[model samples]
Target: MDINMKKILLLGMGLSSVFLLSACSWIQPLPGAFNVALLEEKDVTGCTKLGTTTSSVLSHVGLYDRDTAAIKKDLILLAKNEAVNMRGDTIVAISPLQDGRMEFAIYDCVK
Candidate 1:
């Protein structure tokens, strides 16, 4: 390979490595994790239904692999954050969407 071609190849590889490393921490859990109850439909009797919310994780690049477990964990945390924002005590009837997203039915329960 010529000198110019070799330099281009090395730059491409360096950039690829950087992207891969950066993607590793994309789904990290929150510090001092807040507790948001995850409840079933039957368990929502005394709770007041607030509203529905959704969260999603998108792949950074086509070359990157999807981490389902991490995505799920992040989605749960996202829902919990939303619950906190809405001043709700629990999340009920949680469902996974066809895309890399989670749907949450939020509720404010009697504590």
Candidate 2:
């Protein structure tokens, strides 16, 4: 009877030890302890196109530089004028090309 009792006690203790050790392992931090949850991506848009126009103020020998300056001023004025006309939400891209030409674009970025 004593032998049987000892055998049962040993089996119970072994089973409990196994369960306790398994539970203890789960208490420790995992390999990726610092892992963070991923965030959802957000939509974003920027300038995608450009438009340009040019006006010839004058064309004469030895005065090309002066004409070029005038053309640049006119293009700048035009761009400012167009920019003011934009209302609410607007995206704009501006660029200047050779020979007194200006380029820019504006588009609705939000849907």
**TM-score (all chains, Cα) for each model:** 0.66, 0.30
Which structure among the candidates has the greatest TM-score? 1
As a TM-score, model 2 comes out at 0.30
Runs in model 1 deviating more than 4 A are: 1-33, 59-61
Per-residue lDDT of model 1, residues 1-111, tens digit only: 999999999989988886666455454434422667888889998888889899887634455655666556667777777888887878864676545688989888866
TM-score of 1: 0.66
lDDT values, one for every candidate:
0.73, 0.39
Scanning candidate 2 in windows of ten residues, the lowest lDDT window is 35-44
Clash pairs for candidate 1: none
List runs of model 2 lying over 4 Å from the truth: 1-62, 67-73, 88-95, 107-111
lDDT of 2 by residue, 11-60 (tens): 89986765444333112222332231111122224432223233232222
